[model samples]
Target: MMWPSQNARRMWATVATFAAFLGGFLAYLNVEPVAVLFQGQHLQNLFRDVFPPRLAVLWERSGLWWSVVETLAMAFAGTTLGLAFALPAGLAGAANTTPHGGLRAAVRFQLSLERALSSFFILMVLLIAFGLGPFAATVTLALGTLGGFGKLFAESLERVEAAPAEALAALGASRSQQICFAVLPQAAPALITGSLYAFDINLRAAIALGIFGAGGLGAELLLAYNTLRYHDVLALALVSLVLVTAVERVSDFLRQRI
Candidate 1:
């Protein structure tokens, strides 16, 4: 009737969790394992068609180079615009930094609303108002980034050491003055890091926005896919991969410096 030791309970819990996962995985796997070997024929055919990616498509296709440039521009502008809004919203949303409870609540609610809508959905709505193009994609990415960045920046603000701000307050500094002198200096690093991260995410979202007529590499890629141009798809995919990787490396380097 004695209770099990902590180690024994932990071990039993791990075993039970593993058993449940295995059972669910087996139940969900409707296809026979042997069928996987035969499935390679279709995979091989796909690889054969997709191999030797048509790098020439980047040049041979009219406006493709411009389209890539447009996509990068959209991502950059969107992140910049989103950060502009998020900076103020984040300041207002932070419990310590906000001027009042009502303002904080209102800002938090607005951020929640913005974060709730995905960029793809936002693009759909903007398309009706602005028509199809990179403009819609830029706006979509901006809104999505705003919501997420606002919340992140607010949290960063709230986590900054209160002592400096309190000391500033005791020295007769106004809230805005205190924030400028004390809070902002501490939070600036996080704000920059978050903005860069959002830019990376927006770049990918801008591509997806192309599927819905936002006119970036995504739209071009979708066209290639719809036409069953496997080589083109593979080529476009490689470009996207290289672009994302390069951005990620640069962002990582900057973040480390922060």
Candidate 2:
């Protein structure tokens, strides 16, 4: 292969130097300091910790199964609600579909306000409003969707087939009619895909929140961890891995189909 020119070599040199500096800084901070095999005492524990795995924990309470089901339900409900609110809000915010620039600005402002709210804070507020229950966790998931998906939905509406909208306007269609007949058709695939992606992510988030007293398998896992019930912890870990894999498979299938 031909050697790179001096400019290319300089660029590569800069990249290598930056990489080495970042690695050094990370090492200084001990981010995963024990990542090194055994790193000392961990190696000793490794020998002692290894034992027969318990697969029975999967059916121990039976609710592990139910919790998984409930978790999925929570994910669906929160996503649907978020999308429900996002649809009209997105249209109102869209520059073309909005009735006026001022109303559009207000929609944009509310969308911005939603984005500014933190997921963790929303979770806390839900906990206060509804108590430490799945309802609170579901609200947090919806808030997350509102921030991320709402913006994308608005942008999609703004960029959809303007020609069709103009044609509809020429036919003396109202703004709502233009949106229903012209805008939504062009934007459906992208908008639905975004919602699906957000739903999958919120599935994982719901699980974590559930673990943190949001009421689900997560709560059980947290309990197992706190009690030093390593077997239960391992079981829950495997269950979560399966759930995450299933979500990924479903997401990939939708992506291909959509």
Candidate 3:
């Protein structure tokens, strides 16, 4: 019988090491997946209570539709605000478009720090200052959008064809003129696509923020959950799912056209 080759031996050893570590973690955590799923009445009760969702709540609850509108408004306003700031930040952050190396580094670092902080955490802090509702949530979403889109916009700008900018530079065009004509034109499509994607993400974030008293469908869901109105909670969940799916579909269509 042929012995295993060196590469094959190493591959097997790697797999064995991963398996051992996984097993160790499972044991240490005292996890019993099989028992948890099959032995618990909790799952059965949840299914029983949440099934046959109360879709009628859509009409019965007068403010439900308005809350949905509020969520959409928050996302739109936040994305617009973020995009306004992010465009300048992105220009400064990009290697080719930046005025100076130090500025680029500083902008990149600030964007990274903003991205590292959770949007929900930011919302909580803002709630203390702004005192609840959509204003705080809007600002939180705007900051998140700023951090994410700033980096995306910078990368997009950097990826633009260098030839156009080089040609402009050879023609004795100023730095700002070269960027405005050569760089931005090429990056426009990407920027538009990224903005749409950012709005999609912000919409979901707005809904989640509402659960913490930001005021939207999530708030209604939380209220229902608190009162043990599982049926209404299920109904609200379906509404949220539909809203997200619809926005995603619209975003996809727009991206395809772009």
Clash count, candidate 1: 0
The regions of model 3 sitting more than 4 angstroms off are: 1-16, 27-30
Tens digit per residue, CA lDDT, model 1, 185-253: 999888888888998998887777776778878778989999999899999999889888898899999
Q: lDDT: which is higher, 1 or 3?
A: 3
- In model 2, the runs with Cα more than 4 Å from the true position are 1-12, 19-38, 43-53, 254-258
Using lDDT as the yardstick, the better of models 1 and 2 is: 1
Per-residue lDDT of 1-258 in model 2, one digit per residue for the tens?
A: 645797799899999999899889988988765466646677666435533345687877767788888888888888888888888888888887778899989878888887898677778778998976678887777777776787888899888868998998999999889889999999999997898788788888877887667777777788878887766777787888888888989898988898
Error of 1 at 183 (Å): 0.8
TM-scores of the models, in the given order? Answer: 0.86, 0.84, 0.92
Worst 10 residues of 1 by lDDT: 31-40
Model 1: lDDT to the true structure: 0.87
| RMSD (Å) of each candidate, 1 decimal | 3.4, 3.1, 2.5
Worst 10 residues of 3 by lDDT: 1-10
For model 3, how does the per-residue alpha-carbon lDDT over 10-69 read when each residue is reduced to its tens digit?
899999999899888988999876788899987989899999899999999899999999
Whole-model lDDT per candidate = 0.87, 0.81, 0.92
